[model samples]
Target: MDAAIESIRSFNRFFTRHVGAIDARFLDTDISLPEARLLFEIAQREPVAAQTLQAELGIDRGYLSRVIARFEQRGWIRRDRREGDGRIRSISLTEQGRAAFDQIDRRQRAAVAQDLAPLAELERDELVQALTKARLLLDPGAPMDFVIRPARTGEVSQIAARQSILYAASHGWGRALEVLEAETVAAFLRDFKPDREQCWVADLAGVIAGAVLLTDEGDGTARLRLLHVEPFARRRGIGDALVRSCVQFARDVGYDRIMLWTHTVLDAARRIYARHGFECIDVEMHSEFGDPVQGETWRLTLEA
Candidate 1:
């Protein structure tokens, strides 16, 4: 915990200085960083309430009032009393304020672009992904906009590695599980059937939040495999979305049924499976992970 705390603090210190450097470039502009940020916010949410802005920015009410006063003095903003409650006022940027915002926005973007000029395309992507993951980790309640897309090359191995590490840490599973995941991933790629089999990943920006794969099991049956969500990205319906996409793909590919094997300890996953109309057909005691465990086989029938 101490190491983690120190690491975060070190990063915070570096990032603070880095931002100060970015702001230093803004010296030529008329407005300061805080004022520019507030102006941008007002431009984004025009006719916004002062209380709302205060809550969103988490700044002192007195400080916010002073900023508002400054903007008013410069004829950059106007405020009007609410139609019903004369005490409540709504604020909006004037045309002059918008011109200022546009100028500031352009400078900010150009400064950041110059800062990132040295990094390659891939490095920039990785940087953005790392920042997104960090923000999600710190504030899980923040809005998560993700996409379900076909798994690309190298992503399969990444999914397998993440699943292996997460399961080993969370469930105390051994190398047996990891080996199985690796082998399955390898075989799936080696003899991949593009027509009938499919794999999808929940992409949070450039990061993989979750993954699910459908493999043809001969005849008219398909197997759902490697369904796992990152711990931090769980509870946001990523798992359910992965499973849903897999099942829909299986059905679309003319599969009559889909099956999956899961352990009893994975209640959340089991619940997701059940919600997708999968029924547990069998359970058995197995030592697949170097310990006796109850494993169940679930099957979902597809409608023609």
Candidate 2:
């Protein structure tokens, strides 16, 4: 174990030197690696909560605070204070910040291209796979723990809790969503039919990162329920995998059609649904989750 650790550290030292990560400025930019990453994250998820950002980066609060303050002073970002809490701030990029981020992103991509220029197509593929594997090994807690498996005992409540917490934090939907989640999961559990209904949990390093459920809705139709992915673990194929699981399961169980209810604001989920042949069949305006959202029902018929 010690030898393996030393080997990884040695590789990191060499990699840092090769990438100029040890330099005072990253990629010859004015910002350090941490600052560059913070900028990138802010740009990616604008109107993001600072606490969520801190959790996503897993960085020191004090250090991140200073970086954000610097950005504010430089007119690169504007942090809006919450009405009830003066300390709670939501951060968004200014025009200047967007321009700066674009410049940084261009150089970052160019640097990667230059690094890969010497490799053949096959070698490039292998390098990417190797890098992904290295990250999976180094950071066991990372989203790389990509596995889709069934929910275990006592997992229903956990799934509900995660959904509740994430929706509240991201959408400000409040406790109504949480109560609905709890009821939905509880009903699923109480009326469990192994052959007819199933819930899949996406596990990341033994922790639940996301979940979805396929349940019998009668009349040869199944309903997809509670599809969600953790914010930090998104864009890594977890959401797609969960959707595929439901589709495949529905086909396997001889369901003639599958349907789901979701809000229009969930663009990512909508994309996933569309990719899997699901089409919006109906839409209605509703304020079920504390906002005037268009509730949509999407459906896909199975091919015999």
Candidate 3:
């Protein structure tokens, strides 16, 4: 917990410094960061309630009142009484306020664009995904909308690399695991059958958050392989969604049953498989990945 807290604090400090949050005037504007943010939000939700602004911004009532009063003095904002409640006021940005908001918005956009200009397209997408994932982790209420599409060419190796890194960091697994994954993916692609095999990636924007591959295993059985979700992207239903996609694809392709191999240590993946009607059919102790682990085979029988 201490390490996690320090990491978060360090990131916060670095981000604030990089964005000039400590500056008296934000983005060389005439207002502080708080004031600029309030102005932008007001413009976004014009005729918004003062109470709503307070709730959204989590600012003290007195502080918000002072800010609103200052805006009124500057002729940048006007407040009108609600029809049913005279005490409740709706705030709107005046023409001058709109102009000020536009200027700040343009500057902010340009600043960010300039900062990202040096990054390649892939790197930029990765940065956006990382930022968005961090926001989602900190704010659970943040919406996460991702798509599960067929894996693109050259993406299989990326999936293998991500899964290998995640396992190595979390489970202390070695290069043997990565080698195994690479071989599995290689063979799956080498003997690819479009009609009987499929691979899907959970794409959060342009980022691949999770992936799964289904392969024909003969005798009307489909094998589910390389199921994984990025650490930052977990608990957002990406894993379960990928599993469901794989299962549905198997059923659609006339597979009689689906089977998958997983370690008992992976409780989350086990739970996802269980929720999808898979049952453990076999278990054995193995040290294939440099650790003695209970390897289990889970099977899901499809309805005819």
Q: Which has the greatest TM-score? A: 1
Tens-digit lDDT string for candidate 2 (140-249): 44635579999988877888888888888878987888888888888899998899889999876555668999888899999999999876566678999999999999
Model 2 residue 247 distance off true place after TM-score fit, in angstroms: 0.6
**Residue pairs in candidate 2 whose N, alpha carbon or C atoms collide under 3 angstroms:** none
Ranking by TM-score: 1, 3, 2
The number of residue pairs in model 3 that clash at the backbone is 0
Task: Return whichever of 1 and 2 wins on TM-score.
Answer: 1
* Consecutive 10-residue window with the lowest summed lDDT within model 2: 136-145
| Predicted structure with the largest lDDT when compared to the true one | 3
Q: What does the lDDT read for residue 125 in candidate 3? A: 77
lDDT of 1: 0.89
- Candidate 1 structure quality by residue, lDDT tens digits, 1-304: 9999999999988976766645644546766677877898899998999999999999999999999999999999999998999998999999999888898888778878998999999899889999989888888767878899999989998888988899888878879998999999999999999999988999986778889999999999999999988876877899889998988888787999999999998999999999999999999999988779999999999998
Ranking by lDDT: 3, 1, 2
Residue 23 shift from truth in candidate 2, angstroms: 27
What is the clash count for each candidate, in the order shown?
0, 0, 0
TM-scores of the models, in the order given: 0.95, 0.54, 0.84
Worst 10 residues of 3 by lDDT: 135-144
Deviating ranges (above 4 Å) for candidate 3: 1-18, 83-87, 133-141
lDDT of candidates 1 onward, in order? 0.89, 0.87, 0.90
